[model samples]
Target: MSATAAPPRAAGRPRRTSVVRTELRRGVGPWAGAAVAVTLLVTMYAKAPAWQGRWTDATDTLHIATALLAGPLTLAAGCWQGGRDRRRGTLELLRSVPRGRLRRTLLAVAPSALWPVAGQLLATTVCLLATWPYVGGGRPYLELVAADAVALASLGTLGHLVGLLVPWRLTAPLLAVAGYVGLAVGTYTESPARWLSPAVEHASPWEEPVWWFAPASAVWTGGLALAALLAYAARPARLRLLALLPLAAAVAAAVPVLRLPAEGPWRPDPETTRLVCDDGAPGVCVNALDRALLPDISQALAPLNERLRGLPGAPARWVGGANAPGAGEIGLPDHTMDAVRGRLRNPDLYLNSAVQWLFSDICDSGGVTEADAERLADVHLAVSEWLAPTPEDYGVPVGPGAQRHLDALRAGSPAAQRDYLARYLVADRCDPEEVPVP
Candidate 1:
């Protein structure tokens, strides 16, 4: 090599690649890869089943898991790398390196960012695969993946910055964990803390983007990045505070532009109600008060009169006045009377399940008799059958488990109904007739 010859450049430009390599050497911790694999497996197990059914419900779980796992890990990695100079008492040595302070800082922190990027990529891939079978074209998946990637990158960057700024070894991990918790809580509470967390925007085809880049979140992340850069520069105290400008601007921007809704009582909106009615499985409807409330004999069946015109008949109409009360009799019709009001007085059946309580209430009140209950049951059964095709013997097949449920209502004891529900309603897979898991 000639004396005073300039270092060979890649593409005729002095290569920054070595800096990246150095950053990787210093920033990529020993445990990062192991943590990534563990996180991937856990996320896949939790999210892959969304394709089986209850797609929304399953995706929600995935969203939460991604945030919790990725968020804290990002912060931890950044903090670990940030403390290196202090731990080694090599801040002066680091300053002596032959590069601009900002460039050197970038190089030092760049490697740590790699792990978070990889982790986010893995999460996005898993989520896509889980959702792809159900989504038609690639557009929806692409949109979701793109949004997720941006959101996660911003989050990782923010965590990395915090790790650099905070000098305390133990305090960084605690802050990371606390930040994760606080962001989660803010989703439910709409508190100021939520501003710090990245808003994962998993938009479905029918819905609009959900805060893909909220101003506060963006500002916080950007501010963190700038602060880390300045810290690397070893800027004076006067300039250190300037690192906060982006964050302040972010908060200011969000105040008017973001306008997140306050947390409060949630009355069912028209769209939600329509979604429920349109998509609800036969015999399965969304209750305003609860996600899984189903209609049983007590709510609709018990209120009708036995003498109503269409007892045991199609398009049945009520003939007797509801005003004229009748005795609460139990069991099927007699030879003389075509229809009779039967009471479900089996206390054991009545107490074990929510459905039983509903049935008992109807029977106890001068509500509908057995004939009235039967008519309503039949209508629901027919609707359910049309919606979810199953075996005829089990009753109208409404999805996978509706038939079994209707059968239980027909002959199984209350205990049997409860046990039957446990099989699919709350278990690993969708019951078809079952509501979403809480």
Candidate 2:
């Protein structure tokens, strides 16, 4: 008697087969090893002294890289896993059944490529959380999550398409490497080129109309994803058309949504970037610092500006603190939190440490007693030197003679001091601002 065949599967109803699941489970081990290897590489590089706090700094960047890589790796793995059937000649047996190319490809691709995206997103969150305490926390954790989702979905589709395009074993890795290189080159390019990178723009701390970015990226990534998915569904033409999605997305994002009114004095001066502030800010205030401390800060800066003005070519006009309504403001980027933990442990690039270094030098001189006014002047000199603004630079007016004092400070070795002028020198005399009568 002839061998009996199995019943045909109903149209659009995929046959109940454990083959896809089993293949995915079996293929996961190697990919897991790859992920471990990548993690180790990042960990080793991050611990180097030169890159101190680098792991924290690079966390956001790493999240993007991980997302970008996940798609291709999963696709390759799926393809490799699916290829076994072809090598064994079981592909013909499977194809001979009721399921068409699309359903078969979906069954082959879904488990290997789609399932791993969840794991990637989870890993990204864990990595970011681990870096929070060390670095000033991750950059808005929510943004990272969304970016990862887009990256994984796009890559997964691309990988599946690649798998379908090249049924051969050797082609996937070579393609992956080439694709990675192309992505790297495109991402790092200047002006016109930066838009071409696979990575999305890092959001500005300022709240503006960034809604465009999400949709633009989605449309771009979605198109590619659809193309890739279609390729997996055995539609080559759709995959080719979708290949342009990234570029299209880049073009959309690169074009400014809201152009500045005009580049004139009346126009909003980017130089005077606005400070993040709260209500009843009795004076021009930065949210990053306390309103109560404004008086102390103003007094400390005033004498320094005067001493600097005495020098040749001192700034004709200098304003301390956040600008008044018409004037521009200077503060840290909007991303900086009011409460920064380890930030204090870091060096003070601007004021306190600089003052301390100069005061230390003044103290080292034998038989020279330094008064509060003298110390203030010396620290002021140190600051001018550090600022080192070019001709016509905005800031405190420092003349030529003061520049000489600054030159001396730069040449000398300075001690590590935290509260150079503001806290230590006049803490007792400094008057704190009282809460205003509401």
Who wins the TM-score comparison?
Answer: 1
Candidate 1 has a TM-score of 0.53
**Against the true structure, what is each candidate's TM-score?**
0.53, 0.52
lDDT for each residue of candidate 1 in 1-438, tens digit (9 for 90 to 100): 889999766685545676576567664543553465468557667544332222333344445555667667766666776777777788789778777666676666665556665666665566555654543121232433343344455555555556656777785678678867765665653454443455432323122234433333445455555554564455555666666675566556456434554421112233322312112111122312112212222223222222111222111111111112123222211111111112222322222222222122222324445654444454344323322333343332353344454554557564653444333222322122233211
Model 2 regions lying over 4 Å from their true place: 1-23, 29-63, 67-79, 131-144, 190-196, 200-209, 231-342, 347-438
Q: RMSD (Cα, Å) of candidate 2?
A: 13.1
**Runs with alpha carbons beyond 4 Å of true place in candidate 1:** 1-14, 29-34, 51-60, 136-169, 190-196, 199-206, 210-220, 224-245, 256-258, 262-438
lDDT of 2 by residue, 1-438 (tens): 446977667787644665565645654434633563365346434532321222323444554455346545554555565555656667668778776676676666665555555566555555545544543211343543465566555665566556555678886676656666665566554454343344533322222223444455455555556555654454445554553565565445445422312221122223223443322212224322223333333343344443343333232332232343333222221212211332322222333322332233222343334554454454455454553322343245666655665665455443312223223233322112211100
- Candidate 1 — what's its lDDT? 0.44
lDDT of 1 at 167: 74
- Estimate every model's Cα lDDT from 0 to 1: 0.44, 0.44
Which 10 residues in a row give candidate 1 its minimum summed lDDT? Answer: 332-341
